[model samples]
Target: MQLPLIDLVVFFVYLLGIILFGVSFSFKGRTSNDFQTGGGRLPAWALGMSIFATYVSSISFLALPGNAYQSNWNVFVFGISIPIAAYMAVRYFVPLYRSLRSESAYFYLEERFGPWARTYASVCYLLTQLARMGAIMYLLALPMHALLGWDVGLIIVVTGVSVILYSMLGGIEAVVWTDAVQAVLLIAGAIACIVVIFVSMPEGPAQVFSIAMENQKFSLGSMDLDFTTSTFWMVLVYGLFINLQNFGVDQSYVQRYVSARTDAEAKKSTLLGSLLYIPVSFLFLFIGTALYSFYQANPENLPAELQLSGNADKVFPHFIASELPLGLTGLLIASVFAAGMSTVSTSINSSATLLLSDHYQRYINPQISEKQSLRFLRIASLTMGGLSVLVGLAFNGVSSALEAWWALSSIFSGGILGLFFLGLILNKTKKPNVIPAMIVGVLAIAWVSLSPVLFSEGSIFRSQLHTNMTIVVGTMTIFLLGFLFTWLVQKENGKPIKSSSD
Candidate 1:
């Protein structure tokens, strides 16, 4: 496959560095709580960077540029919505969630709603997290498969094991610190690749910029006020809601903050992560555009097999294999690995916490001791990691990693977030309204799945709307229905409304 030798060396160095960092931290984490949540003493800065690293997974590092190569830069607007969500999380969500001093974010769902609500959210989270971890493993294996001729299964195993080892050993403290390290490596690799691409090009940055402009990749328009046919409204509303749900409502993010020593520290970490994400994400998207320019300038450089796919999603990795110098190639591979490991580790720890705190502890045995809980946490972590790898291998034909994740995310985010929001904002309910609301929401989403039948043979919206977008819209509709039903029921009862737990 002609992978670069020096690149391999540098890449291994990065991997070794990550492992060493985790190992160094492992000794300090002798207890279950210490491993899982760093004993709630994470430095705000480390926590912030960990948030970015964990959030920007292998998909963002490697898959995103590949997707951008095919779709143009319109997708970059997704970053624009991040800051707004960050503000909401730091100012509101993190503070409240941290105040609960709970190990699992799902506990808040249990506290405000009910045990049923907590169970539902935790199950949804476990499903979503497992799917995401699998996708990350599958996608991350692609470059290795294409470049080094490695078996995809072996690649997945190696990737999954590496993450589990560190996460199991070092706990949340190691995850955050290593995540910070991974975050730096991840961005460094991207910037290095971009710089190398710029250097390799004949006409340099100016020419590349000119080509991107000509291709209309820099534009984020369609402010034409049509939610059905325009990216503007979709990007604004969908992006904002998705981001809010992810950071504000989801346990993955909440786990990061909950590890912090104080609410203020958690808020700082969130705000810092949010602000840094804007520029970092922009650079990653720019790498994709730069890649498009690179391929345009030298079409023959691409492998013949890739051209048959007739898709640009294959371009980014192809460049890494054929164009990059040996040392740089290694760094790029390490960078992608770092990205994948950072995310998988976070997911493993978070999922284990959910199982332990919300499921195993709450239901299986409330009397379980901390040492036993720790043992269960490790088992849960390994179990979830294994499940994700299996699921990833099972779903092999998916086209774009980013799209698959977004599609899966849209499936549960709206309903879960809706429940959380209701618990927070709509203080009128004491009964288990969220359960019915979620049931109604899930059913409504199921009904919206039938929208394809409603469309006539000549409908243009079919071409305009992606299936993922359709799911999100359907989920949103369900959330609103749940809200409306709850409100109507509350009004009929005519009792004075109670306040939120806040």
Candidate 2:
């Protein structure tokens, strides 16, 4: 099913609007401060929307529906933990970052521990963002390839280049405003798909619900307490830790905090963004449930390739291409790109900010002019964007985009949150103890993340610990070990442990 002429027009027009809107902001900010933090003049509501859009990502737009379609709604438990994370961010992280008034989130680590801690965390963040950008690009291209039979590489190049151009030109203001628009488009797209599913059903939404219930597609995952399997508890715990990193420590959200007008505004933005995410996520998950019901009732309507392959990810795109009215299909497709672009643009901007603020300015050249700093920022953004495209194109043979991303995220996060916890809660943790604790934390996380592969079948160390527990375990390991080491050092030197206030 090819897109009609009208749909093509709609799709291209949406892309053009995003590009032009983003580029429009490029002219407003000539200095590094203006570009990096929007000069602290952005509105809370708009920044909130931008944060929501950035967090959702193409992975949520595409993979989340597939998650619900293929299995049960247990994964939705992840949303329940988001508010808690946001509360922590609003109460602690937001005020801390606002008070510091640093362009990079890692700057606090330097003040708390040393430059080494800041550098290590920034590197981990950069690596994770690069992988994320690639994954997003790959997910965005999937529908394009399916709809137009276009080569995946070509789609990646075209979309990636567009995002890079606008992100580099517009800086933070453009990214935030365009993200607000994209967030609306994302919600609209999901709602449109739900409506289409309901209308297409002979029995309507009631029947759709009945079928979903009958198929157990509405199950909230397994209620078992087992940690080895992806039970409800496992996912809930994982979501809590992951969301903590996202809200409390991730450069993306931290950058948004810096962009807001005040600490109160920043806190409001964090809460609003995260609170809205709960319902919006359910909307996407419901689409998957509705899709499952719609297709089961009308198996004949399922795409032939999807039917044979049984790929849940293809189901949404297949429906859009085959059944949607001309203009609507394009709108939905553009929404997918919107989801991808919001996150990718943020990653490029945030990663570039970290490179310049945490490294270049801190170490190599502290007295660089605004013009030179802005130049470096743009160059760094372009470079990271290009590398992400290559990484996105290289993704192949992944069974589930959602699972793949979670696994990758766990590996790259490397318990940096533990370092933050240590700094905030333990006064005795000095600079000397920071590096050792981080080293132990990374190794512990690596063991948890890679043990299954490294130990193989029938090995003692290859215990049945779930991947969801990796961050939690890793964080604790770092904090405890770091604390103990600091205590030992203080005691040996005949000195008392000092509190964080000291």
Candidate 3:
């Protein structure tokens, strides 16, 4: 079904508004520092909102509800770990970065370990963000395809181009401010869906809850301790480790931290973003349960494709297209676009920041002029955006969007969290030993992350380990082996391992 004329107007107006709003910030920053970090003058709340928006991509918008609709609330175990990760970030990581006054999050790695460590971490970050941007774009295209009957490729290209243009022209300030807007729209959109679901039901909210409970949709998670399955323990552990990566090591959040006006503001932003995520995530999950109840109560309202495919992911989008009144559909669709644009813009800007700060500036042109650097930043932003589009196109036939994204993220995180753990926990570890430690860390993570894809179903590694355990195993392996290797090197040289300062 096509959107009504009014709905089309609303959607187009929203796209136009984003472009205009982003472009307004283009002339606001003149230098590379201003472009990359917003001259370190962004407000706390705005940064917090941007951080939240950046994390809540269209994948969460679509997949979370689908996840809840199909299964229990086990996946929300991931959000439970965010607070713990955010606390650690505010207490240690934020202060460390602010004190260093570095543009790149990986700069501290170079200081504590070596240049190679910084490069490796940055490369991992680039790969992770590319995968992230691609997944989000592809997910966004699904709803658009459903709504307009347009080609998914066309949708992806149009959305990708729009985001790249805005991000490339306006820089981080534009990205951050636009994200603040997108965040509000996304939350409002989710709330709107919930309200519609309740109102549309014959017996209302209580009926929805009763039905969900009867169906066991509210179950938090499984209590099994099995490592080979997605038990509560497995997801909880995975969530903790992955959240650590998000708060401690992800360039996206780290960039937000550095963009804050002060160290205290940065910490505040982290806490605020993390706290906000829990309720918002719950809202999305609730929408899923409510959706299940809503559709069950009125099977006639469900889409034919969803009915045929039994794919829960399409249910929400189908509802928006077939059920909601005209203008409201457009608004919700705009919100979906908002969710996607906020994340992709951040990815483009931050990836470019990493390329310029970590690589180009470090190696090719340490003393490049401001004009030249700004030019390069724009070029890099556009290039990354294009590459991400290609990546999105490449991932056309995934079995499950959310699961595939999580697996890709685990692979690319590369256990850099372990490297940070080493720097923070063992102050006396020698810098020179970090190279071998990182090598071992990468190899171990690769083994765990790739075993399922590379090995047969009956292979020992594939049969024994759950995918969620990859990060936990990879992180621990890196921290322990890195520390041990440092010790061994120190013993062989007959010298005490010196502190980072030494």
Candidate 4:
């Protein structure tokens, strides 16, 4: 169903408000430092909200619900892993990053190993952010296409340009503040959907639960130890690794780490951001369960198109377009965009920051003026946003957005977390040892991630492990092999094995 005139007005107003909110702070990017870190004066609450919004990407808004609708709450186990990761990040990474005077997350990598180490990790981070931006943009286009009946590619291009303009003009301050607003919208919108679902139930809210229980919609997948499938344990392991990677090594996250006014503030922000996802994830997943219940009780209500497996991602959006009242529908749609915009904005800004701090200043011109650096950053943001548009268009017919994104993330992440672990926990990381380790890890990662696609069905040579294991295998291969290689080198040179403090 197309949005009514009032709903269209509401949606456009919400978009305009977000754009204006960002553009209002455009002057903050006058200097490279202001653009990158908001002069290091942002409050903890805002940063925390921004971080929270970043975590609830369009994947969470749309793809996650789709997963819950089509399957079960298996991936919800992923949220169960966040607190542990948050604690680790707050305990080690916050203080470590706050101590650094550099804006780039990979600066420590360069300090520990060399420029080569920094470049390698930076490249991995940039690639991951691009893929991240692309996926988020693609998911962002879904609701737009559903509501306006616009071509998905056209929606992507238009939405990408809007985000590029916002990120380019406003930088990190805009990102943080806009993110805080979007975070509220995300939660509000999700709660609204849950409430609507419950209110619409024929037998009441309790009926939704009874129906879900009857259907086993709330199961967290089988209690099996099989790594070949995405069982609870496998998903937990994947979540642990992926969350560790996000909190430990991701530039978009670490950039927020350094933007805080104090160590306590940063730590507080990390806890707030990470723990908040647990309940919010429950909401998104339950929306799916509730949706299933709603449909089961009134099977005639569910359209035949949404009944198809691939269209699971469109279930929540279809509900918004068809079931909700006009004004609320617009609000909910805007909320979905909030999820996408916050993430894409953060990615564009952080990617630009990396270009300036990690590459341009570090390599091309160390003595570049503040004005020149700001110009470089703006241009870089636009360029990265454009590249992501191309990739978003590439994801035209993906079966499952969340599943596809997790696989792509693991591949693009390329075991950078493992390399970071080696540098942080082990002293005197050798370039030679790390190089060989990275090569082996990348090969392992490639084999695990691609074999399923490259090989035919029932091929003996295919990877038996689930796609989520791509990060697990890649990270372990790099760290374990790098550790072994490093130890052998140090022992051969008559040196003692050292610890993190050494």
**How many pairs of residues collide in each model?**
4, 3, 0, 0
| Stretches of candidate 2 exceeding 4 Å from the true structure | 308-310, 396-405, 428-432, 494-502
Tens digits of per-residue lDDT, candidate 1, 111-197, equal: 777788889888888888988899889988877788778888888888888888878777778788999988988888888888888
lDDT of 2 at 377: 94
**TM-score, one value per model:** 0.91, 0.96, 0.96, 0.96
Q: List model 2 lDDT by residue over 32-51, tens digit each.
A: 88789999999999999999
Pairs that clash in candidate 1: 6-327, 7-326, 7-327, 7-330
Which clashing pairs does model 3 show? none
Q: Which is the better candidate, 1 or 4, if ranked by TM-score?
A: 4
How much lDDT does candidate 1 score?
0.77
lDDT of 1 at 224: 67
lDDT of 4 by residue, 222-271 (tens): 99889999899999999999899888888888999899998899898888
Higher-ranked by lDDT: 1 or 4: 4
Question: Which stretches of model 1 miss by more than 4 angstroms?
Answer: 228-230, 304-310, 397-406, 447-465, 470-479, 496-502
Minimal lDDT window, size 10, model 3: 426-435
Better by lDDT, candidate 2 or 1: 2
1-502 per-residue lDDT for model 3 (tens digits): 7679999999899999998999888866468898889999999999999999988989889989998998889988888888889989998899988988878999988888889889988998899888888888888998889888889888889889999988999999999999999999999999999989989998877999999999999998779887778788888888888888888888889998999998899999999877899999999999999999998899888756686545888888888887787799999999999999999999999999999989999999999899999999999999999999998887778776656777788778857899888888766664746666667766777777677778987877653677778888878888888778887889898977665556
Tell me the whole-model lDDT of each prediction, alpha carbons only: 0.77, 0.87, 0.87, 0.87
